[model samples]
Target: MQENEVITDRDNVLFEAGIKLGALYHQFTGSPVNLDTVDSLEKGIQESISVQPCVEKISVSINRDMISSKLNGKYGYCELEGRMLDVHITAIFKTAKVDVSLAFDTELDYPLMKIEKIY
Candidate 1:
């Protein structure tokens, strides 16, 4: 940016949303989890991310069916995968608010993070 450039709240929020999704995915993926601990894991992730700046709200959901199918015979738990997470976050900077999500896109076969809305 040039010296006179000004960053708007909308820009800040959009950037922050990407940062939040990236951090959450990297920090939590590969953690061990079973059906019994899934709920707690979701809550833990949400609470942890909620403390960050501009994070107004967050929701995390792990696909229980996917978890069950992916569990190995020897171990009753599976490592968390990006494909298993369905996350939504609302972030606000000043008057600008943005909603974003991380979810599995069947067409893309990956966890896709995208801006849902901005206002």
Candidate 2:
């Protein structure tokens, strides 16, 4: 952004949504999780992100199959990873609201963060 250029509401909404997604991915990716605790983890992430400015709402879902496949026979948990998360967020800044998401893209073999819609 140029120093004197205007920042629109859509731009602010997208920026806030991006910050939320980045925070969610980086802050929780290495945390320990098991099938039994997945629900709490999801809710925890949602609640934490919801408190940020301009965040209208947020959703977080962790892949249970992925968790199950990686549950240890002894320890019985796996570290949360970007590939195991399916997340979406809506942020409103002034009159603009934007939808954004972070999810595993199987074809690309990566977790992709994208802007889904703007209005």
Candidate 3:
């Protein structure tokens, strides 16, 4: 996908799922949280989900709102989900950044799979 391309319904659902899952996996696994892992994370996610024919393309976005909160030990996360594309973000005061993970299946409304957190 292009760097600035806007997400659309025509995009592959599995790819979308992989992007979201990859973001969550890296978010929870990183120390000091290197946002660069997003690329590697995306690659890993794509490889795992490539078996699914439904997936076509994938994209991801990260909110750097926490840039100033580093000194304060404050961490934040952003995630989008569902047809309405609800957004949720939370800030926490801790050594590690928070993570946001979500899982879905053929049906959009119900979460068939999920990661522990969404950061």
Off by over 4 Å in 3: 1-32, 64-119
Better of 2 and 3 by TM-score: 2
lDDT of each: 0.94, 0.92, 0.36
Question: Which 10 residues in a row give candidate 3 its minimum summed lDDT?
Answer: 82-91
TM-score of 1: 0.94
lDDT per residue (tens digit) for residues 1-119 in model 3: 65998854423333444455544444433333334443454445445544433333333333333322332334442232222111222212232222233433446555333423322
Residue by residue across 1-118, what tens digits does model 2's lDDT show? 6588798888888888999999999999999999889999999988988899998878899999999999889998999999999998989999999989999999999999999988
| Candidate 3 collision pairs | 99-118, 99-119, 100-117, 100-118, 100-119, 101-117, 101-118, 103-113
Mark the 10 consecutive residues where model 1 has the least summed lDDT.
1-10
Better of 1 and 3 by lDDT: 1
- Give the top-scoring candidate (TM-score): 1
lDDT of 1: 0.94
Give residue 10's error in model 1 in angstroms.
0.5
TM-score of each model, paired residue for residue: 0.94, 0.93, 0.26
lDDT of 1 at 1: 62
